[model samples]
Target: MQEISRVFDAERIQWASATASGHTVNSAEAYQATGVSDLLPRSPRQLVFVECDVLGLEPAEVCDHHNPGDPGYDRQPQEYLQGSSLGQVLSLLGKEPTHEQRIIAAADHCLTHAYRGECPGVDPAELADWRERSRAARFGLTHEEIQMRIRIATKALERAERIKVG
Candidate 1:
């Protein structure tokens, strides 16, 4: 556990296949294993903490967490998790502004891509293309594997100290 945590501490990107499991997906225990809780976003809300739910899964399954803050002021364990489906659960998230990356995404309003149907002016063909690209990129992921990778990526980005890939 200590060795793996060392790796997570050094790399904020995806976890290697050896260390992850369903139980540790969103728990503080996982964060502890990585030893990098201090670097997470300040938001009481964890949704915006996610830069991309682009991982091939339902929106509900993205890095979901449930952090019931402690009795007083100390918001221990955060209030979010990495894989959820309930709207009400989303509501309980921390009420803080998104971190910088999220702000950039919101400024672009990329979420609109998900519901482009509502935007009469946007081209339908464009939406189809986007979906295709996303599908192509996620070709290797099973429905469940997709959800799991997204959760780990989201949490690591939000809380891990540093992340890099080669």
Candidate 2:
């Protein structure tokens, strides 16, 4: 555990492989044994984070849609997330947002492509392609595997002392 955690903690990124899982379609090993792949979005927070980064926007910019008091708050995504079919499912499962909420609250809005629907200065087709890719990436992963990746990432974040944000 320490060895694997060390890899995740290093400034330079490293990759490892899981022994074997019947689910993976490529490389026979989950990415660094974390079960992540180029094909998947990991989680909503990661998906939004990457999208925000690609668009030269911060998660806060995307998340402000969640905060009613913010000047730039959009309200639409928040309302939609709260009322969408996915939202109802999450509620039914009693799984309220955790990492996703913190990530959005830190930035102040919904940063997802689906949530945003259309973004200015961004090619809608490109965003749609990314969304599709994310869905595909997660295809082979089981729910448990996905959650395991999130838990490991959360642990790494908790252990981080200086994230070197610019």
TM-score of each: 0.22, 0.23
List per-prediction Cα lDDT, in the order shown.
0.33, 0.36
Which TM-score value belongs to model 2? 0.23
User: Runs in model 2 with CA error above 4 Å?
Assistant: 1-64, 70-72, 75-118, 141-166
Query: Which residues of candidate 1, in runs, are more than 4 Å off?
Result: 1-48, 51-116, 140-166
Give the deviation of candidate 1 from the true structure as CA RMSD.
18.4
Q: Give per-residue CA lDDT, model 2, range 12-76, as digits (tens).
A: 33322222232322432322233322343344532222111122223322211223443334444
lDDT of residue 100 for candidate 2: 34
Stretch of 10 with least lDDT, candidate 1: 76-85
The per-candidate count of clashes, in order, stands at: 13, 12
